[model samples]
Each structure stands twice: as C-alpha cells, then as structure tokens.
Target: MKKLKFTIEDKKIAELLGRQNFSTRESAIFELLKNCYDSGSKTCDIYIESNCIKIIDSGDGMNQDDIESNWMHVGKSNKGYKNEQNNRVLAGSKGVGRFALARLGNSAKVISKKEKEIAVIWETDWLTSGVKETSVDFSKGTIIEISDLRDIWRWKNVETLITFISRAYKGGDMKIHVHFEGETYNIYPIFEGIKMGENYVSKITMRYDSGKMRLSVTIESDEFRSEVKEIIKPISERYYEDVFDMINEIKKDEVEEPEQYLKELGDFSAELYFYLGRIGIGKEKFMYKHNEINKLDTGVILYRNAFSISSLDGKKDWLDIASRARLSPAAATHRTGNWRVRQNQLFGFVMIDKNKNPMLKDLANRQGLEEDEYYQLFKNIIGFGLSRFERYRQSIIKKIDDKNKIKNKQKENNKNLKHFLNKPTTVTKMSEKELVSLVDEIKDIQREAKEQSQAREESTKQHKYDVRILNVLATQGLRASAIAHELHNKRNSLESGYKNIIEALEEYGFWEELNSDEFTRVAYKNVPQTLERLEEINIKLIAFLDVILNKIEKNKFSQKIKSIKNSLEKIVETWSQQYTWLNFKLNIKNDKIGEFRITNDVLEVIFDNLILNSIQHNELKDKLIIKISVEINGNTINVEYGDNGIGLSKKYVKEPKRILEVHETSRDDGHGLGMWIVNNTLHMYEGEVVEIDGNQGFNMNFNLKG
Candidate 1:
C-alpha cells in the first residue's frame, strides 16, 4: 500500500466532506441558495437534467484567473464592499455556502463577469477525480453546471419553501425566479394579491414614522384581516407580555392615548388572496407561519409585494379580538384571520422597496415619511383585536347560560305534560251528585292544605324583607366614617379661611361685627358645605341600604301561600311574556280539587321560585305549561305541582349531599335559597315533599295534615 501519505491541510477537505452529510436534498439546496444570495444574484435558476443539475445567475461572473484563484479554491473568501451611501447593504459572508453546492453535486462549472474586459468560466468534475478537487475554465458571465444530480437532490416541501422566501424578501431588492420543468415560479412580496391565470388583486399602503425610523407598507385588500393579525399577535403576546406593562409608569387612569404603544410598533400592510404558489427553504419555510394569518377565516388572503402568503386557523382561542363578545361563527373566523395578518412575517416585509431599499418609499415616489404619531392612532384598534379573544371567552359563557336555559325549558314542559297526564278528570256527564261529591272532597282537601300552609308562609314573610342586621350596620358605619373624615378636613380649612376673612373685614372697618348671614355664607361655602353634602350622601346611603334590605326580604319570602289560581296565572303570564309563541293551557284539576288549603303565601313562594328557576335554567325558547292537582285521603291533603322545566338533575335528587339547597350562591346559574325555603316551609306545615324524576320534566308533591 502507498501508506496514504497526507498532510494536516489535506485532511481539512476530508473533515469538511465528513461534516456535510447529504441526508435530504433540501439541506443541500438551501446551501446552494445561500451561495446565490451571497454572490449578489437578483435571481438564481436551478435545473435538473437526466444526469446533471445546473444553476445560473446574473451576478459578477469571474475570469479564468479569478476562478482558479477564488471559485476553484476551498475554504477561502473575500469581504465584499457595500454601497452604504446609497443604502445598499450586501451579504457579508460567502465562503461557507460554497460547500453546499460542492456537497450536492459530483461536478460544477462557473461562468462569471469580473468588471469590464474580464469574463471567465470554470468547471470541477468529481466523476474524474472521484471527489470535488480539480477545476478548469473558459469565458465570462456566471454559470455553474453540475452533472449527476442524484448525488444530492431531495424532495422539497413547497409550503416551507414559501415561508423562507418570504423572510428573505425582507431586503426587497432581490426577487427569486424559480423554474421547475417548464412552469416558472416567482418568489417575491405580493404587497398586492398574487394571482395566477387572471385572479383579482387589490393594493393598500400603510405608513408609520416616529422620526427615529420610517416604515411604509403596501398590501392586498382582501387579506388585510389576516395580515394585520399575524403582525400584532407576536407584539401583544411576546413583545408586550402584560400589554399594559408597556405603560409601567402610567397609571390606568392616566392613559389618554392607549394606542400610542401600538403605533410605535410601526406601520405595515395586510393582503389576502384565494391562492398563490409557494417559495423558500423547507425548514426555513414560513408559508405556514405566514399562512396562519389566513386561518383567521377573515376571508382575506395575505400578500407580500404581489405574492400570496399566509392565513390564520383555529377556534376563537386567546388570539381572537372579539372573543369576549358573542360572535357569529363567521365573525369569529374573521377576527382570527385579522389577528394573524398583523404578525411579523406580514408586517416585516414592508420596510424595504422593490429594489430592496430600506428607506420607506411611497406611491408618489416621495422619499419622506408620515408622522410617527399618526401610526399611534390605530393602537386602540389593535388592542381591540387583542380583546377579541376575551370577547370569545364571554361568548362561551353566554353559550353555557343559553344551554342551561334550554335544559330548564324542556324540563318545565315535560313536567307540565306529565302532571296533566297523571291527574284524573271528572268521571262523567253523569248526575250532579257524583260530580259534587268528587268536587267536595277535592275542595275540602285544598282548603285544609291552604290553611296549614298559611302558618309557614306567615313566618317566612315576617322577616323576608329585613336586611341582614350585620350588613346594614357595616355599610352605614362605613359611610358615616367617610362623612366624618371629610367633615374634619373641611372644618379645619373653613375655620382658617373664615378667621382670615373676618380679620380682613375688621381691618377694612366695614362692619363692627360679623352678621349671621355673612358668617353662614362663608361657612356654607367651605366647611359646613362638606358636612351638608355628607348628610345628603348619608341619606342616600340609607335609602340604598333599604333597597338591599327589601330585595333580601323578597328573596327570602315573597309570599308563603299564594292562591293556586294566582300562582298559576303569574307563571303563565311570565312564560307568555318570555315566549310570545303559544298561549299556555293550564288546567288545575280542582273540581275534585278544592281551593287547596296551602298558604297562599307559601304556595306563591314555591310557585314563583320554581317558575323563575325554570325560566333561568332552561336553554329553550318556547311557551311553558303547568298543571296542578289536589286530592284528599282521610285526614291528609296532597297537592301536586309539575312542569316541563328540563328535568331535575338526578344528581340533585339521588345525590342530595351534592345538590345545593340554596341555588343562588351555588354559581350554577340562578337556583337559590328559594328551593331551601320551599323545602323547609313544607316541613313547617307538617308535610312531606316528594320529587318524581322523569325522562323530561320534574314533579313535586306535598302531603300535609292539619
């Protein structure tokens, strides 16, 4: 064997090749693209043939001498100069990218132009040396051709490609022209909508200048919502964590222009479209990232310099601006789309021009910028977008409320039907004697139950409206204390001011003594006035307390036993008002049913409580039905109340431990102490209350003995 004699420098190529593995063609192609970018090519074309792949560019082509010295050389590079005076910033690094082209193919050739009087062509073939080690040359203009493409081609994800391209488009001066087969792809900003085969496009521009920097944005109209959202979401979520935190020094009350912060973010445009082809690197693909704005369902496609890009998607999560408010399904999608539009990918595309100038350019070709404060004007609107997510949250809550209402409504209707079905009707068109007997018995039972119920009703009603003694004491005392504090401050100021005024009067010798009217005016204007105001406030405070007391009492005991007819009427009336649909039919089977002897107050309390509960708990919108029946057996009277309120939760019955007796504070919508009170009142009347669980409605029966 030759013993493989090799030097340390020779080992460098081996190391470089070992490090650059070609697992996927995407990794290699990216390297090639980077090379093109560094070489200052406005466009780089990639073509794959049967046995070879080629890349061509319009950059500075090298001469034979330059190719041998630089292009054919490995791991060596030159720092390129930038035309800073004209605001042209070139890519500063290049040597690292050449390896990609070498790693992707078995051979390469280059034709480039070096200044005037010089143009050269160079070629390296791995097939000959079995490695990327040699080079040969010809004439000018830059062209690199490598054969045996299978040496490095891999499948590419178009979506990711577009995203990468979109980011690179930030410079704005470069445009990528891709030719796959005979079809051509143009990678650039679609500030206006990008259309293929006669699609429509609209353009709009936005500008922001705060003196420090100026930004001008042009985008498509249909995609505005999506583009705007994408731009802002990052700012609101990442850049400004507690968006309010951005104003740390300013108190909430002091925020006169809350939009100021958002405006400072600069101006950008949003363009939406129906469709567009993709660009960029597979890993670096920003299409999905940008396309996310389109998912907002705003019906707008985003564009960057005439190319269709990203959109938004997903339910109205925290990203929605109107999330806290109820939104039509369509509107929710719209909000989400708009949010995505305001993102970095979309907004970042606008700072440079078609020629890649960082200085914001206008439609008029005017070189100046708009005032920075002008951009601040839209801050609140952006805040509104942030708030949309909250609005979605609120909408969900409302949905829950609506669902409960429907459930309760169904329950009430089913109960009503069951009760009506269960009750026994008059036996016949027979003699009066039989009908009268049945009638008498029912009346007797009802009358007895009503009387017994009255006692319980009276007890609860007595203090129903009374305020909680403790709360009244605390609230009144607090107000009084405030009044005292205010009066103390006033008195000090008044006394000092009054004394000075009197001294002035005495010095002027206008009067020998201060009169009551004059003294009163000064005191009223200063010290006593505060006290008087406090007194008025205290009076109002007492009145407010009284109102609370009244409400509490009403809640505890509206009426213990209301007449069955009246209770039924009220329930019917309420339902009628709420559901203007069908008029209800309530039949109190009381002919055999007597004027049930339940406390009109207690009965009313129970009836109203249940009715209100039904109204609040159900998710339906329809008229309600209720049926009541009274029966007597020896000394006991039984009264039944049933409705179609969505059936009671079996949990409430079977799991009494879990069922809240007081529904009010239960936070389960609006069931409250009324249920507790109803149950207790029944107990007070020496009665047992039984609930019947059904597939649809709830039924309750009270058996009382007087």
Candidate 2:
C-alpha cells in the first residue's frame, strides 16, 4: 500500500459545519446548553448584547490539554460513548456540538477552569483559523463569548429563544436566564400553567422499565365532577404497526418479538401537558394567556436526558396526531377534527436517561433520532399512547357536550316561559254598561277554558289508548315468535318418537301378527309413550296459542269498566304460563277492587307489554322475579311493578321519561315500542308511571284512576 494523506480544507469545512450542521440559531444555542448540562451545570445564562452574545455556565470547565484534545476535535466525542460522567448521563455524543459556536459567529473566546486549577482561555476565529489556548485566573466555571453576531437579535426572536430554553430546561435541575437590554427573563415563569386552556387540561406521563411501557393519563375540567386517570400498557406489535403505517403510508414489517424491540429502546419517561383550546374549562384570564402561548409553541416535544431535541420543537407533529384526526373526522372526539389537541395544542418534555438508552443515537443534523428500527419503534410507542389520550379526551368532551345540551334546552324552555308570562295583556276603561258586557265576556272566557281543558284531557286519553294498543300488538308478536320456535322444536321431537316406534314394529314383524304379545306391547306401551309426549306438547302449544288468540280477538278498544284485580290476575296467569322461567308474585291489598273506567282489553294490553318488557330487557341470570303490588286509595289505584333482574342504568334514571319514547330501547332485539304503548295506555286512564327506588332490577310506581 502506498502512503497517501488526504489534504483537508479547514475554511470550507468550517463554513459547511456552521451553515449545514445546525438548522437555526436557536438550535445552535440549544447545543451549547446541552454542553453545559453535560458538564454538571446547575445554571446557564445567555446575555444578548448590542454587538455580541455570551453564554455562561456554572459547570466544571476544561483545562488547556482537555480543550485541545476534546473541544478542538471535529466529529469525535467521548461524552456519551461510555457513560461515566459524575452519575449524570450525557446528552451530546457527536463532537459537532462545539460547531454550534461556529454557527453563531465566526470568532469566539472561551475561558474555563476546574477547582483549584489555573483557568484556560481558548480563542477560535472560524473565518480565519483554528483555536488558540492561553491561561487566565478565573472561577471554577466556563464562559463562552462570541463577538461576531451572525443573526439579528430582535425582541420577538429573543422572546421565542427564551421560551425554547425554558421548555428544554423544564423538570431539570438546571435553570436558564436570558438578558436583553435591561430586561431579564427566567425559564420557569414562562412555563407555569402552560398546559391549561379554556375547556380542558390534560397530563400524560409515560415510564418505561424492563421491556414494558406504562403510561398514565389524566384529564380534568371544571365542567366535570371528577378527573379521569388511566394507566395503559403499550406492548402490542399490531398497534405499533398500525400507527406506523398510518403515518408512513407503507406498512412496516411485523416484529416477531415486540417485547425485545421495546427493551432495546431502554428506560425513559415523558410528561405531556396539553391545552384543549377555548372549548376547555378554565378561567378566561388564564385561558387568554395560554391561548397566546399555544399559538407560538405546541407540539409533542422529544428530549434526551433533560434537554429538548431541537428539530422536534415548535409545531412539529412528529406523532402525526393532527393528520389522523383529519383523516377520520367522526373518529375524532372534539367538535371538529381540528379541535383535537394537535402539535400546536401541546407543550411537554420526554426525558430519557442516556445510560439506559445508550443505543438511542441522534442523526448528524441533530433534528431527531436516527431512522433505525429502535427509533421507529420508540416513535410508534409514543404515538400509540397519544392515540389513547385522544380517545379519552373525546369521551370527556362528549360528556361535557351532553350536559351543555341539557342546560341549553332548559334555558330555552325558561326563556319561552318568561316570554309567555311577560306578554302584554289588553285592558280598557269602560262605563257601567261596558262593565256588564265585561262580566258576560268573563263568563264566556271561563266556559271556553273549561271546554279547552276537557278537549285536552280527551286528546291525552285517546293518545294513551293508542299507545297501549301498539305496545300490546308488539308484545303479542314477540310472544308468537317464541311460541312458533318452541312448537317447531316440539314437533320435531314428536315426529322422531313416532318414527322410532314404527321402526321397532317393522323390525320385529309386529304389524304382521295382529294379536301377538309383541304386537300388543308395541301398539299399547311404546305407542302410548310417544302419544303421551305428543299430547303434552300439543296441550302446552294450544294454551300458548290460546292466550295470543284471545288477546287478538278482544283487541277492540272499549269504555266498559273492568275489575282491576281480575284484569291483573288474568295478566299474571297468562304471562306465568307463557314465560315458565319467570316467577310472579302479586300482592293486591284490595282483592275485590273498585271497577276502572278502562276496558278489560285495554288493561290487558298494558299488563302484557310491561311483563314482556321485563322479560325481554332484564338479565335472566337467576329466576326472574316479577312483583306487582296494588293498593286502591279512594278513586286512584296505586300500583307498584318491579322485577329482580338487571336494573336500569344511571342514564335511564336521569331521564326516565325518555324510556317512554317510541323506538327507544337498550336491547338489541327490542322494537322500542313497548314502553311507549304502556305510557299511552295509562294516559287514557289519566295515569302516569314514576320511577321508584329499588335494591335490584327495574322498579316503577304508577297511579291509575278507578
């Protein structure tokens, strides 16, 4: 091999590193802060002067030899290679972090010292030459002064810069301060209450340990009674692949062992604070401030160690949450897809300890992680966690919206009532003759009111009767279907038994011998067993069919008074026979009850629908208990109907009246017309059902005019 040395151009390389290595001045500044952090700095300060910028840190500084070998070297760093730095994991690996100085300005001077050592001063003019070292007496800390400023430091830019530093330094021991003109800015104050917005505040914390990722999320709002907290384990390969494919447009190859891939990413924890916008619940003052901050800064930010990843900052949707929302609008929980917390609605930090995640490396540009399997898997895991948060947020928003809708409806009703009450009434001053005419007018008005009341009552009664009829018809249809199904099964069993008897007779040649003992046995004993079973099935079928036929035959509505007790007893008997699985208990205080104006057919319809609804809706885990207690108090009969089955949900309790609406049911097989019919039927008799307290199952009390 011939001895050959590649000559290098330092000026061109320096310019390239300055312009291409870092994306912006803010990113370059972040790199410098990382260095301070790695050096065990507890405080870092940035001073923006008219002509120059200076960065100072209270960290263990470098010596002459240390500066020459490490600080001056390009593309070579030992910071995160082994992880043995005073029990603190390093944030920088590439030596190019020093090139961040070059990105800032062409000339720079650094003065640094260790405890009980002479300070070393280094000067570098990238526009001209390399670094020069000297000695100086200074405290045990580092000070970097750049004289040639590259970019204009406007007030707005400085404000943004301070915000970036503050976000990066959150939850870290290090504190950063910025000085511009005469004003001083600290990082902590800017980030306070940054997560809360008008309608909602959300917090998500994720911890990774032993190949498992556990995420805990909390959503809170004044609109709701309690905050919701959920802990989730994100470990499914299919979930990761689904989210990954959603963003990348190409499906990633499935990992054979996903747990192993998670292990490789190492232990890390991240906390995300999101503001849900004006629709969220909070004070207007704080909301205004939060909204302003949200406009400038929002995103799922990534931080290694405690320092933020530069390229992942400021409205960068690395998780692609917004895109997912747009793609599936209905799938989004908030009012609009944009209402979902996107990159611009969030501000947070992801903390990763380098010692645990030694393999997690950044790309050369320092924007984000290397596009390797481990990094991709890490992104997918975070995305999965966010997706879950979105879903929870949606549910919370829906609850809030429902409550708001009810409130709005109530307000509207009140407004209408107020308007009606406040309406102007006509008044006229009149003579004695006119006063006499007024008396006559008053009498006519009273008569009209009476007639209106009577008409309204009749209309209500007619509506109730119609509802009852519909409910009866529906219940009968269901019962008929059940009976038909049972009949078919019973007929099959009977036919099979008959076929077996005939086969036996033919096999033994019993039919040929008329008076033989074998023929007698077949004809009498075997044939009778089959016939007895058929008879029993036929009787049960006929009884069930008879109940349906009797109801249909007397379906015509009538005004004939009927005995309340007798009607209830008949309903109980019919239902008990039809639903042999159910247990019915009736406690009628007055067995010989007063006659009701309602007809027998109408009463039967109401009872049948209620019984059928109980059977169809209630969970038949045990012997379903149907209890009916009736007490005749004067002209009104107080009736209580209950069942010992799965009770109604709180939703139904809050709005019991909704249960009576047509086509409203919780059961998948229900026609939703049963309760409507029952309600209407009772209305005809000027009766109403009221929800009653019960330990188990659905219970209701109603009053009927007798």
For candidate 2, lDDT tens digit of each residue in 178-280? 8999888877723455434342345665555534343333333332222211111222211111112112111235344555666666877666666645532
- Residue runs of model 1 more than 4 Å from their true location after superposition: 1-24, 34-40, 64-88, 92-94, 125-140, 150-173, 188-706
Per residue, candidate 1 scores C-alpha lDDT tens digits across 219-241 of 33232223223433322211111
- lDDT assessment of candidate 1: 0.42
Per-candidate total of colliding backbone pairs: 140, 9
User: Relative to the unseen true structure, what is the C-alpha lDDT of residue 119 in candidate 2, on a scale of 0 to 100?
Assistant: 80
lDDT of each: 0.42, 0.63
Clashes of 2: 9
lDDT of 2: 0.63
What does the lDDT read for residue 436 in candidate 1? Answer: 63
